[model samples]
Target chain A: MIYELLEKHKADFFVMYASSKDPNFYYAVSMKLPDPAFYAIGEDGTEILVVHEMERRRAERESRVKEIVSLSDVGFYEKVKELGVEKALAETYAEILKEHRARKILVPKEFPSFLYKQLSEHFEIEIVSNPFSKLRSVKKSWEIKEIKKASEIALNALKFFLEIVKKERRVEELRRKVELFVYEKGALAEDTIITSGKRSADPHFVGEGIIEKHVIFDIFPKIRDSGYYSDFTRTVIIEKDEEIAEMLKACVEAKNEAIKIIKEGVEAKEIHDKVCDVLESYGYKTIRQKAKEGFIHSTGHGVGLEVHEEPKIFNSEEKLKSGMVFTVEPGLYYEKVGGVRVEDLILVKKNGCEVLTKFSDYVEVIP
Target chain B: MIYELLEKHKADFFVMYASSKDPNFYYAVSMKLPDPAFYAIGEDGTEILVVHEMERRRAERESRVKEIVSLSDVGFYEKVKELGVEKALAETYAEILKEHRARKILVPKEFPSFLYKQLSEHFEIEIVSNPFSKLRSVKKSWEIKEIKKASEIALNALKFFLEIVKKERRVEELRRKVELFVYEKGALAEDTIITSGKRSADPHFVGEGIIEKHVIFDIFPKIRDSGYYSDFTRTVIIEKDEEIAEMLKACVEAKNEAIKIIKEGVEAKEIHDKVCDVLESYGYKTIRQKAKEGFIHSTGHGVGLEVHEEPKIFNSEEKLKSGMVFTVEPGLYYEKVGGVRVEDLILVKKNGCEVLTKFSDYVEVIP
Candidate 1:
């Protein structure tokens, strides 16, 4: 599919290089770190993987590509010593393109210019739009399953926080206990947004102080082996107030309105506008002098290998896909009055979509 | 002080530029988003900060740089667009350097090459090896206070997990609770490493599963409004065993021994070797084969803006500094036996150093 996209995009052939710590490298080969693995994906549907000695074992273990060439076996580095590190990286990449006889190669915009410049020395390299992000924007069935598993782990941890510790634990202490619970459940919590009181007003407010009654527990976690994430947000009221309940209701309405409009082929930007409208209707103003103060950030974004992936679901013109998974989180904020946000992960299917998070909207625990 | 370094190095000027999302930009300008700021230190010891219009107010609120130039107020982006983003960036920077007109322009080596290429188009650009990491390596009195506050949050969170939460909460739940704790303490838990059992063997393991007996709880948090971070690691024995105890002992001993030799001007590699020797003496073999296996990864690294910063204290000839704050974390791993790591934030003082963490080492629940 990627090869077809490359061909359709008028790329004669593309050279894919993996560095020591690039996640894109991990995505292609499933090997975390490769000692300068190079792949040439030709328009003719031919794919070749060139790996340095250090990554051979893992490449052989998990690589989807069939053809594997070892650089050390061929002394690829020694051939480029005369060029130096900067030139060598470029020249080595060029060699792969020349070997494949690709005239015009499509490369990611974020490709390091030094290497890009070097590759252009041999091939007519164009900084092509990244198609990988779009491909990954949509989730697969297995991916959705993994997300569900991750969400289950997150929701369980929230349940534990409510049922177990009855007294007010230090904010940090609560975070640690929740993390341990989730970690034990075969997933690592991504950003555990446990903000409280005045701090909760900041959309990204990571709270401080002895976590008092009004606390917002927004947990997003990824399953280790699966590399799938689950996002959920629940406002736990240790101490209750009318404002808190109203804010919580506003948040839920905004989020639900957005979630309801999300489906295959739907405009992502329109969904964001709908959420904003819901918040504005509730007499809230956005922080950046916008309509809704609570919804300062985008409504939600696609979630996958990276918690925030591509095909932004916020104020973006990108259209939703059948397999795309995103969050429908809406928040309401008032500085001294505290804040409330309710979020759930959703997967766009053939028809409407499936909400992966099964937890209740309000899990009230009176501490 | 930074300007003095540029003068000493015979560079006419030095500038630090970062985009909106780049954290280093935040470090230099001390202002958050909307502030496209740059800290330009001239040979004459004149420090100038250029920020965008939207960020003018925040820049004044946060930064210490003497001159704050709001680009938008002076038609900076329009001028930049006219000058070309590259040429504009270069010419704007060159104008600052020309004020001194001494000789050379210095930039941090890690500065994006696009920026470098742009600046180099108009100025004699030289890669200025930044000592920011080293400068920030050692914690100051106030910095230590922040880290200690962060550590307290982490330790309290861990203790709460051990004492109150009996059943396995989902990993995400525990992480959220810990995060909330840190926020309440006026800080953000940068990343809390919560991995369990077999997952624990992988040092960077995160996410998924029921609460297992052997869980690795690594928490690093940054104090509110301050970028400084504190890191701590504690392995829990929900089900205790002699092997686990033995592993913990070896790891603690290795970490302590590594800290013993830590002084100003000591080789980073030597410290790593000493720790490795201690672990080996305890019948644990370092996995030299795979970088991810056994006692792989560096012994310690400088910590500040980012969790893992610079001046890696492993196989590095980089000399230590008095104010450098780094981690002296050592771990022992076995394929089936899981892993044990004891980490503490250390302030490299002039004489020896001070351990920032005051958490108990023993794996016992806090009553």
Candidate 2:
């Protein structure tokens, strides 16, 4: 598929750095390597990996590439003796591209400017948007299964959190428990937002102190082995008020309305508009309506290798395609009443979307 | 400090995307944000943060910057309507720079080429090596304390692993146990290399399968609250052989040699050379001597916010300075006897270096 994409782009080779920081690198190599190394795929479908001597054997074993070359094997030391380490590395990469007879090399858009300047001096380098991003956005069936598995683990963590969220329970303690549960299951739970009362008004708040009124338990865990992620957000009501109840209902309805329109050919913006309309109809203001409160964030976002990937399901003009996995999270925030959000991982299918997250939405937890 | 650096460079402003992936971003803002947003520091020491409407409140509360500008306030929607999201973002950034009467912008060396090209069209954009990297390398007393805390957690995790590395125990299972222990303590243990037998011969191998005669357990965990990290590697022998025993002794000696020379004004390369000479004198081949096996990697690297930061101690000409913390790891690898490595985090003081990792080197785990 990458070869086809390369051919379509009229490029001789697609080059990227195998740094775990870049999801495109992992998507291309199919495995993570600690050290940043040169990875290039030739038009002839040759997957070449150039790594340091220390990481050579490991890269050979883990990377999906056919040819693995060590830096020492390619006169890297001799080059370093002449030039500095940084220049030597860039030159070595350029030499590798030259050896491949690659005149027109396609690099990721996020390629370092310094490296780009160095490589451009040698080759006809074009900064292309991550070619594999779109490909990775539309996950395979096994990828969907991996995501579902992660979602299940996250749901279980959420359930555990809900069971323990007493009136006097500290948000930090609840977060720690959730993280421990997920970690024990060989997953990583990070940036968990367990805000209560007025603190929950800020969407990105990683809450602390005693639990009160509504508690937003947003658990996003990444499965350790697969590097796949699952995001599940549920606002649990400990002592619900009339306004908070209405807000919760409106947020849930908005999320459902957006999910209902998700299919192979639906425009992402249309679904976003639907969510906004639903929220606004319930006397809630949205970012689209130029209001500071209510649903301020996007309706959803594509989730895959990275927690956030391409094909954003916000005010995007892109059309949803089959096999695309995204999160449908409609949240309502008020300065006085706190925040209520219900998020679920969804897999867009031919007919509709499959809600991978099985956890109950906004639950009233008895304190 | 960033403003001072910017002024020193004769740059009107310094700009970066506030993405957690870029340590410099977090270093400048003193906060972590999920989404990538615009951040700029002017010559007058004014720190400006432009974030999404949803993240406005959170950014205001968390970010150290006094001036927090929401994207919506900057006519982001109007700009997006005229130009695409990407172009609009760049345009808005350009507008911000123009508003500040700035014509020159200094960006990090790792800045995106695509963004550089966009910004360059409007202003003088120079890709500068992270000016803050040098500052970050020289840690404060509090930073040293944080790293020490991380080291203690990693040491605990390592001890837990040594206890569980009995015969018939899978390396993956033992690794999981170590990770779970660290995660429970609010630290992240990632890329843990627990290789046994021939697999250990590869330094970077994250091992699998049953425990053997020799196991290399390299635990590098970062503190959850403080982004500081501690890296420690110790090769344990379950049923020790003469070859493995000798290798362990040589590695320990090499590490000690490197640490002995670490002090203010000491050359990094001299320390590296000491490690190489010690390992070579023990009849082990070093990378410096152009050998495939034995002491293949650098003696050590500076450890801080990122595991591997500035002031590289491997064939580097830079001199060590006080308050700089680094790792002094030396390993010997052979196809026949697998691998043996001993590493310790050290803090360079005015007089000498203090070893931060407290775990014993080369433990013998009985089945």
Candidate 3:
């Protein structure tokens, strides 16, 4: 698969180096904390791998690569130091590419600028933003199972949050309580969005103080064991406002319409615009200041190991794929009236998409 | 302070760039989103900054630097398209440097390699791996406060864990419940090492199962609000063994002795060896496979914001300093028999060190 990506981009090799702590490194290697390593894929299917000394024994035991060069045995840094930083990096990359005898290399946009420069010195190089991201946007069966497991846990916590809702409970306190329940289910509940009342206008509002009438709880937590991530959102109204109700109804319709149109072979942007149209028709101007006020951000984004991945459901020209997992979140935000958002996870199938999270809309709050 | 560090390194200018999502970027600039931004510090204390077009507004609003240029706004890619990638990048960097009147630049090791190459082409560039790591090693007043807050919450949770001890209650179940309680306190019960009996052979053995022997409960949680971290350990012997009790006493004494010698201007490695000497005097060797299996890893490590920081209290040549917070955990692990580790947080002061976490050393598990 990596060879095909390199060929598609007309590159001789793709070189990536990352520390054990980085999530990007985890994505490339598929095994967390395997080693401080570098991976390279040649256009003709030649793959070269290098790992740190302490990690070599374990890497040999568990890694997916066919060829492994242990840095401890090879004296990698000595070679680099002797060759000079640029020449050594370039030469090392070239040695990997030479197996296939290719002349060009492709790298992710976020690849270390100096390494890219070194490669460019010896071989033609191209910067491809998120070359691997598109591959990861879609989910496999096992991936969806893990995501569902995480979602089920999150929903249970959400239900728990609803049951324990109190007028005096602050947004911060509520978020902490919900996170505790979620993490106990064996997920790292990290990025939590608890926006209340007018604060919800920020969309990513990290709420504080006593929560008012409208509260938006957006949670995207990674399941620790599997490293699969799940995202969910639901807005509850404490003091009923007619405007809030009507706006929420529009967002629901928009989300439903987007889901209906989302499937393999569909354009991502079309679904995004369709949601926007639904909001606009409901008297919420979107797009620009002259447009609607309901939805400011995109309809949704692809979610997988990372909460937000590639094949963005935005103005992006990328096409949807069968294995892709994304969210259909439609929201309405008014400065004074507050915001209302409803989100659900979707896994694109051959014909359509499956909703992963099972939760009711219009969940009435007690008092 | 940053200017002084740059001057000390003889860097005419300093460039710090990290994606907004990176915590290191947050250390330099207080932005949370992904922004392709650069901060240039000049010899004359002048600053030149560049940011992504989309993030310009937010960067300007939040960052300490205000003189910002938009990477996309200046048509940077167009330059690469015209002048060729290397020359374009070098020329662009040169222009930025000239504007700041910089002939040499210091960059963090984590900066993208391509940027490093570009800067290197125009002027001398040094891989100054975030000088702030050292600055951050020493806890500031505010940072210490955060650590204290996190410690208090963790200690409280440890007390809860001790109170809930029942021989019948599964250790794993107790671990989960205690983590939930810790999170409810608005802190991350990130990891709790609950090891019992033979499992204690592994220094980091997180205990499992319902057993009628020694169980070690090590609580290390990060205070979310303050971003400060704390660590504490208490070993409970459900069924006491004379050997285990003796080893525990020696380990506790070693920890205390190490703490007493730990003050400003002392080498960390010296302290580590001193602790090793104390353990060896009791027939316990630092090597794991010896007759009396004892301390396998280093005595402890610097603990603050990230749990593990610089001036590692191991076989390190780094000197201890005032405001440096570290852990003094010494243990004697006996294979299949049991193990005892007493850990406490220590803050190096001018004369001696202050023991921060006030927890009982001897823990007895009542059946």
Q: What are the models' TM-scores?
A: 0.64, 0.96, 0.78
lDDT score, candidate 1, position B71: 58
Docking class of 3: incorrect
Q: Please give, for residues A254-313, the per-residue lDDT of candidate 2 as tens digits.
A: 888788888999998998899899988988888787788888888778787788787787
Order of models, best lDDT first: 2, 3, 1
Cα miss at B187, model 2 (Å)?
1.8
Predicted candidate 3 versus true structure: per-residue lDDT over A90-167, tens digit per residue: 566556666567688777656765566556666787766545676677667888889999888878877888887764
Q: Report, for every candidate in turn, its global Cα lDDT versus the true structure.
A: 0.68, 0.84, 0.73
How should the candidates be ordered by DockQ, best one leading?
A: 2, 3, 1
Q: Model 2, which residues run further than 4 Å from truth?
A: A1-9, B1-8
lDDT of 3 by residue, B1-367 (tens): 6788778988888777665554555555655554345667677867666754434544666667667676555656568557764456557667877766777788775677656655676788876656667777788898888888888987898778777876346877788778878877878874487887775765654567775577777888888775678888877878778878898888888888888898999999888888888888887877322222567666787776566666578766788889999898898776656678889998889988888898778888766
Better of 1 and 3 by lDDT: 3
Worst 10 residues of 2 chain A by lDDT: A159-168
Interface RMSD of each: 7.1, 1.4, 5.6
lDDT of 1 by residue, A37-137 (tens): 57667888777777644345445655787777655455455664576555665665566566677778887644554566556667766655456677777
